[model samples]
Target: MDCKVKLWEVYGDRRCLNTFIDHSKAVRDIYVNTAGTRFLSAAYDRCLKLWDTETEQGKPGFTNRKAPYCVGFNPGEDKQNLFVAGTSGRKIVQ
Candidate 1:
């Protein structure tokens, strides 16, 4: 329920592929990149994580004092360092 990410593939039938549990609080949002190889997840733990779709593992990405609500990766190829995350504190962290 909390601090978990479920991977599902809906090709012909519904099936859960895997689940990732690393955060200490509920995961708020998940954002897949354009490549579809990796994704970003925001959690109530006030942290952002980067997860590999293949490995099904998450690595600590970013963090702040306020709880993170949403996250998005930079679509531009050369702008990977410029990601954005919205927090409950009424501000967007870059």
Candidate 2:
């Protein structure tokens, strides 16, 4: 998949919640916030995207480094300002 994040409502009938196509390459990893209100995605396209879970909408949130292999929200103290990402360059960005 070159660029797609398919949010599915696995509860009940199991269907799509939303479809986000912001990356130009395969999305490598996804992470959710502790409160469940938001989430983030890192992709091979060297981009990170943040989503408002309740509204099913998103925006490009982070970028500037190499393509990432993983991304996650940081919880507990200072959580709102902290996010983590792992890149193929063998470095972690926070």
Candidate with top TM-score is 1
Instruction: Judge candidate 2 at residue 87 and give its lDDT.
Output: 89
lDDT of 2 by residue, 1-94 (tens): 6588787988998998788777778888888888777889888878899988788888756885688888877767466557888888999988
Question: How far in Å is the alpha carbon of 70 misplaced in model 2?
Answer: 0.8
Best of the candidates, lDDT: 1
Model 1 pairs whose backbones collide? none
TM-score for each candidate, following the candidate numbering: 0.88, 0.86
Error of 2 at 52 (Å): 0.9
Worst 10 residues of 1 by lDDT: 77-86
Candidate 1 lDDT over 1-94, as tens digits, reads: 5889888888967898888788889899998887777888898888899998978777766889999888998889777556788889989988
Worst lDDT run of 10 residues, candidate 2, spans 72-81
RMSD to the hidden true structure, all candidates:
1.5, 1.7
